[model samples]
Target: MNKLSSAIWFRQEQDTLILEIHVQPRASRNQIVGVENDRLKLRITDAPVQGKGNEGIIRFLAKEFRVPKSYLTILAGARSRNKRIAVRSPRVYPDWMTGSIQRALFKIS
Candidate 1:
């Protein structure tokens, strides 16, 4: 594991990146709001009714990580604000993440 994996918000396992996220639905905008209680915080404009928030999270994360929506998965907390996501072979890391994480994403083995 790389140094960033030790962080509670995210970890890298093989080619997959696992993220611990706390989402606040029906917010003023859709954006990453840093970490809270060891999980990455996010504010989404979509309401939490009828899985709209979950879909919104997937769409937002897909764009942030530069991955296809099919490459993203909600591993846990689909029915709640707290969620765990897995990104397979992500092409890029969001600028909000630490610089080390950004470098790690493109590091060749």
Candidate 2:
């Protein structure tokens, strides 16, 4: 486990959870890899162009977190692989993610 695994990567923004993410585009498949330097590492199937990777990230996260895509917002790093995304009005969060809004994604589903 890296540093972020011990702590959640999310920052509360009103009713949203802002997650710091580091993406690896054009990977073999799209999936949550692990934590690296406090950022959630994700492998993106889409190439980093025309926001395709960004879109993939949002869609994957929405499905993973069991939330609507509209509720997930890219707060920063839209054009870069490293990004900060926000999940709004979440109805469910994995038990492992109790305190850490950010690091939880790495350990759990």
Candidate 1 local distance difference test against the native: 0.85
- Relative to the unseen true structure, what is the C-alpha lDDT of residue 52 in candidate 2, on a scale of 0 to 100? 87
Off by over 4 Å in 2: 1-4, 94-109
**Cα-lDDT of candidate 2:** 0.78
RMSD of each: 4.8, 5.0
List the candidates' TM-scores in order.
0.85, 0.79
Off by over 4 Å in 1: 1-6, 100-109
lDDT of 1 by residue, 29-98 (tens): 9998776777888989999999899999999999999999999999999998999999999998777776
Q: Which whole-number lDDT from 0 to 100 does residue 15 have in model 1?
A: 97
Model 1 compared with the native: what TM-score? 0.85
lDDT by residue (1-73, candidate 2, tens digit) is 4533545456666878778889999999988766777787889899888888888998888877789899999
Q: How does residue 3 of candidate 2 score in lDDT?
A: 33
In model 1, the Cα lDDT at residue 61 comes to 94
